[model samples]
Target: MTKSAEIETIAADWLRRREEPEWSSADQVALDQWLKLSTAHQAAYWRLEHGWRIADRIGALGPEISRPFSLAASLQTRWKRSRTAAVAAVVFALVAGSALWFHQRSDDVVATASFVTPVGGRGSIPLADGSRIELNTDTRLHTSVSKSERKVWLDQGEAYFDVAHRADEPFVVYAGTQTITVLGTKFSVRRDGDMVQVAVLEGRVRIDKDEGIERPRPAIVSRGDIALSRGEATLVTAHALGRVEDGLAWRDGRLVFDRMTIADAAAEFNRYSRIHIVIVDPVVADIRIGGSFQASNVDAFVRLLEDAYGLDVRREDSSIIISAG
Candidate 1:
């Protein structure tokens, strides 16, 4: 193997050893020397370091080991002690910046540029960057992975991303006209008709207008917050962390509704199924319903609407029309 390839390989090995609680002092010293040999060595080591951090968050390397090792009992104690100096030198190469990266790249060359999931269809896509995207029905997304950034544009529907961290590059997802930017964070974004909603399951995300402005951005969504943009402004509602996942859990064929009006509730149900719901009675349409329902059974949901509120249902083509009894 070439020198750079050998360095990358050794760095990967050091990461494996670091994850284990039992690391001999000799191994530590060798790792220190490997890290200091050249700039490429340091860069490779830091790449492994960031991988460890992101892996820990996703529980990739197994359980956390808080056990401490003492340098006083080893042959390479002096070498391991000197390795602390390399930390500062490696920061630039290892750390991912917060700036957003955008590019006008085509998604061609791979099968097709984009694909749409029909109603009741769900599938997982493995991106070139090792990140995985779970796409829900009636969804369309265009993906382009580049050396500087990873971006996916969601034209419509919902998708959950378990993003892989790339320290040298930033990952950006464009849903509707808004851009959701992150270095490495787990989140879901959905575009419903004219509305766009973003829920962060882990880490953090930046939501901003398509056209950049020099002014301070409106909001940075962290865990437990739902950012919904209608037209002019984005509304952030603090919700239970569990509900945030449940809201995006439609990828698992589950639908969750919490104190939502019939009109809003019907809209959600319509997205996943072929049978759409139309509310004819304004009064009944405004009534709030709260509960969890399976997305597969549209007939059962129609039955629930009839059972809960005394409403008459009319089936027309592909939609169910509801009116006051």
Candidate 2:
């Protein structure tokens, strides 16, 4: 078996052992030590354990959501379906609510929703499990929250997630090539067409790409990692804690830029406002700019461009056209 597979096997074994009546606190300590040995161990355990929770919570939220399934007097519940995801196998157990073992290919889901934030506006969604999603401007998002799994699709734009940890249930976000598995992490995902960016602020998240999707530059991201995914390419890099905070300045109504190109800044601002900062000249577009600006104050940004940077700025309708003075 491959290294990853071996780790998963060990994780499954640990999960099974913990259900034993004889399992003690020392065993739990040992399991914790093993998980800390590698990020792979954590990911493996999270996925496998996520599977075991499915039988208890197959349906979506409603009055029946709290109701649990009774497998049988003797046998355990089996998986509902299989998916073509890259997973080799996911172990599940319920021998007697904590005993039998089997493998499942995917999550059992019932609830689904789709929502969006208007251009230049923000919105928040609270799930039944106490997890919350904050959407950025012009964002389209779809969600499925089954009893055992929470999945989100960022069809376009950006969103911030403050997840409540349910170790048994996995919280996953899909954006471009990113198949992000969250263990109660606070992070933001942004999708601009074919490119996707994930900036993590708290806790760690696993980013795995789908097999049939575009090939990615594989990366093992840790806490505070910035993961960017595009067609046939992905880049993962770590940042200081503060840089991660700055990346989330939008939550506080601020835009922080450090030596960002004029064109790039314009695109970032365009996401938060209807006013367009149009720069057609290569010279003006290539000039690097920096500083913190209010996300909604495009007029202040325009005045800065014209007065401070000595650039010619003309307003025509909704477009603020910039050129070299």
Candidate 3:
């Protein structure tokens, strides 16, 4: 097995042990030490843990079979058979009756190009293969293109991709712990810390965790589909195509929030500027905010918050603080 496969196997074993009643401090210590040994180790553990949580969700959906032969229990059983094999089986069984789409291995990749956009900066690049990529503010990414495959690693921030069509060579994107594969499509991938969100604008894409385990049933995301994966779980939510287009307004230097929380809106606004927005009160943070604003215009947003919400705004050295009236 490859080194990645070995690490995934170890991670799966650790996850299995975690479910046992006899799990103890020593096991936890060992797992922690192992995870600290390498970023790859941590990633493997996160992927397996994510699959476990997905199994729990599947169980909750069907409480009848969940009683004795729960999806979670079945996954634990099959996991011991073989690390890579179990993932495919578990996902296939969980999403029964759905079409199975397996992950395809691509040729080896060597990072040949790198790009970064400064904070509050946006840029676009055309690749050798005719694909175009739009970098959002504060983004970093690397690309590797071979005759057989096209691959990009998103280190941070967000990017919108208009991929060139090549049936013989699939385009793959690696962001955090998620792997997104597509033939030819328009999609956006955002990586914020451990959270990864993928939105498809055109064509179809398959998304799964890149744990070195073969996933035969990845989430098939087509147009208007949004998939989010964080920590130990993943959720796929859908939106109208028009709404999806509106969400990408950031590419055009605007942020359009529709009744989003003030806290969340502040976080979004902060991504495009050095001046941060801080909510001084939890109640104020939860206030609903809506409308469109320029990405770089924090002052305008703050003014609206003060005037419309009847809140107090305080300007500090580096942050605009909002509080309850």
Q: Assess candidate 2 and give its TM-score to the true structure.
A: 0.65
* Rank order (by lDDT, best first): 3, 2, 1
The regions of model 3 sitting more than 4 angstroms off are 1-111, 214-216
- What is candidate 3's lDDT per residue for 1-325, written digit by digit as tens? 3376567667767876786678899989998999999999888778767877665554353332211111222432333333333353333232221111112235322224456777877765545455677788888877655445577899999999999888777888999888899889999999999999888899988888787755556788889988888854678887667667877998888998888999999999899889999998999888887789999889998998888989989889999988998
- Positional deviation of 38 in candidate 3, in angstroms? 52
Candidate 2 residue 147 Cα shift, in angstroms, is 1.0
Model 1 misplacement above 4 A: 1-112, 211-215, 230-232
Q: Order candidates by TM-score, high to low.
A: 2, 3, 1
State every prediction's TM-score relative to the real structure: 0.62, 0.65, 0.64
lDDT score of model 2?
Answer: 0.68
The total number of steric clashes, by the backbone 3 Å criterion, in model 2 comes to 2
The best candidate by TM-score is 2
Q: lDDT for every model? A: 0.65, 0.68, 0.72
All models, RMSD in angstroms: 16.2, 17.1, 18.5
lDDT of 2 at 15: 71
| Model with the higher lDDT, candidate 1 or 3 | 3
Residue runs of model 2 more than 4 Å from their true location after superposition: 1-62, 66-109, 211-218
